[model samples]
Target: MNQTIHKSQEKNMILERTVSADSPRQDELVPSRYALKVGEIDVMVISDGVLPLPTKMLGHNADSATRAAWFSDMFLPADAFDWALNAVVVRSGGKTILIDAGLGSDPDLHLPRAGQLIKRLESAGIDLASVTDVVLTHMHMDHVGGLLVDGVKDRLRPDLQIHVAAAEVKFWEAPDFTRTDMPQGFPDALRAAATRFTREYRNNLRQFDNEHEVAPGVVVCRTGGHTPGHSVVRLSSGGEALTFAGDAVFTVGFDHPDWHNGFEHDPEEAARVRVRLLRQLAETGEMLVATHMPFPSIGRVGIDGDTFRWVPAFWDY
Candidate 1:
């Protein structure tokens, strides 16, 4: 296994650093804890750890210098231009549902360790046994690997209903998901993830043909841009509403909403949806939680002239 690189210094020179682990799990693996309330619904933003990813991976059209100028604070920790992985947890009508299960113990992949969802959920007094549902925004390595433990040990949400974008799943699991233009391990990892969506998981699994109320007060709507069948999960109750825009907007990624991520299946379509979704979120003024934004990634987008600005909310917990 590769060593986790950190910072270090010696007598009069700089020193390279790394974190070695006897076991896969590590403390503070996941940071960025927060929560919110939209009307009567309770929302929690759980950390899936942070990775200093390459800006090139974002697939933006801008040059490295321009991109760096745009996201000045994106280099908060290690002078890294990054997009964070933040998972959303929703509790309503006595039900607990996780929006996305982040990456597990996969180091070969650029993704980081984010299998702490179950532990963090348990810390919040949420019993894994009673987690009624798990709605995935998409089945990327970092999003769905948390469904099961490493080596496929146990079902994280045994009795919960698993929601997926049917077309997206088909594409990833298809024999040619990665042959043409997709990332290297996208298809292979997804195929392994099929086991997590077991017989019971599939029995409870569903796909949104159009807009449908998959759960009480929780509706799954088709919004394909990031992927072929990507969908947005929206919730409304007691006159207040919140939309979990999976990867539609990655922080200021929407600033250039027309900008697309490199990993996206359709850059043009993804760019189109990013602009359209940002416009909708800005115009509607709906509070949103996304799978990847900065830490504590739940906020509303505000319209500032043509571009929309991210308006972060204060999370009590």
Candidate 2:
């Protein structure tokens, strides 16, 4: 009986290996996307993979000892960190809206793990042609690079409308990076990506001033902190609401809301925006999602003494 069981186990292992080898991409070990509902609106959060960045990028203004202590407390590596890249898709009023695209290919940057948005969307059965609109949080490469990926334009509908803030377009016209503290080679890459995206999709842009309602109960509002035109998408229906905060909030913002992130063009104003948004979400008890938060990124904010707390929603599986 023991010999028979061992042989069966070996046979099963061999079969599994064969299947994985035949369809490597389809056999992901972990889930890459999550789906949920906000009242009547259907929402899905897809993971575009992760970006490994230096630890200092978390808070350039913070002292090394303080940053080290925070990292120790969180049990994270002291030298580097992996930032989650998340994009959202919403369906409302018969309109399909893509909140933000993920990082596309950039070999020069040496970030190979990212740029999975296109494949993941396809795996989720979301055809590019089916996307009726795209609402950008900002013109950052990670947010707009997916659209600029080769052949993505050909797949998308010719009449598809891309919603962005007027300030974002104007800022990128002659972008000012005096305040940003990005790593070397980032600013140039960002500038090139933004310029190419704007030039290629000039006619499809539907620039708005402050706020615009793309569909029923779906509103995109400019917050202007991370970038001049940075915005967040708010979905409301059946008395429930959820906000898709672009770069307004990061994972570390909960404990250190005043810390200056390296990517913020105006760090001071960005801090103010983070604090205000967290306070509002805490007071109203509404669900919040952000681009850099962990996958699914669905949760509520609670006031924890002087700082805020992230209450991750329990999986409804």
Candidate 3:
């Protein structure tokens, strides 16, 4: 009896260690990447992990009681929660495009749970050198920091084209945080990350004024809300379409399109942009995915009377 008990304890310890975050990527307990097709374009939504942030960030302008009520209705903690971070890989016209690299590493930020993009990509058989283009919806650290990860630059192709809005690049030069309501130290960290990313990848940036096509059926259009140059990517081929909304819409925006996310540089404009996009998606019936939505973020927007509704797409598998 003693021997059997000891052996069981040892086995449990091994299992725990294997499932820990530091374990090999192959040992991950849950699926980290999801694949789907947008007409003829091949798309994959890879989980970059989650960012646990204060609940106040969800709707900084709302009254505390109202915000708490929303959280309660959603069955989420009223104080804080994890915000999903997702990146997409698109293949069309013989070109591979990456949308919004995940947050790399920021030790001082104490967000060690995120920055899993690179390893997850490798596990999914996506080679950095194979990426022909990168579409950045915005210049936020979480969206561009993955490229700044040590050794990532050396692995990427020298000819890789990074498509971003011209205004986004210019805004980062002297970023305005007066309208943002981020937590302490966020502004400084964001500024530093943007500056570093720009300096390091200046040669690869392909700036567009309003809209640009990075690949066949892959169009990125500037939205100018969350940031001075925030944008979203639209994928259309055959008869299907999907939009990868970066930071423009969040989990809460579906229910409260006007709630101001703390990360928005211009909260009011951000709200307007969210409502406009949701309305358009609802009318057209196009599929939607966003950076901060729950993983596999694929869904369709619906009109819920005066508000909006999120109808998650049924998993193909």
Strongest candidate by TM-score: 2
Off by over 4 Å in 3: 1-27
lDDT of every predicted structure (CA atoms): 0.67, 0.92, 0.93
- Model 1 spans > 4 angstroms off: 1-26, 29-31, 72-79, 110-113, 150-159, 175-201
* Global lDDT of model 1: 0.67
Order by lDDT, highest first: 3, 2, 1
| lDDT of residue 269 for candidate 1 | 78
Candidate 3: worst-modelled 10 consecutive residues by lDDT: 21-30
Model 2 over residues 1-317: C-alpha lDDT tens digits? 99999999999999999977654364465567899999999999998888999889889999999999999999999999889999999999999999999988873899988888999898788999999999999999999999989999999999999999999999999999898888899999999999999999999999999999999999999999999999999999999999999999988899999999989999999999999999999999999999999888999999987699999998886
lDDT of 2 at 255: 98
Model 2 TM-score, all chains together: 0.93
Answer with 2 or 3, whichever has the higher lDDT.
Answer: 3
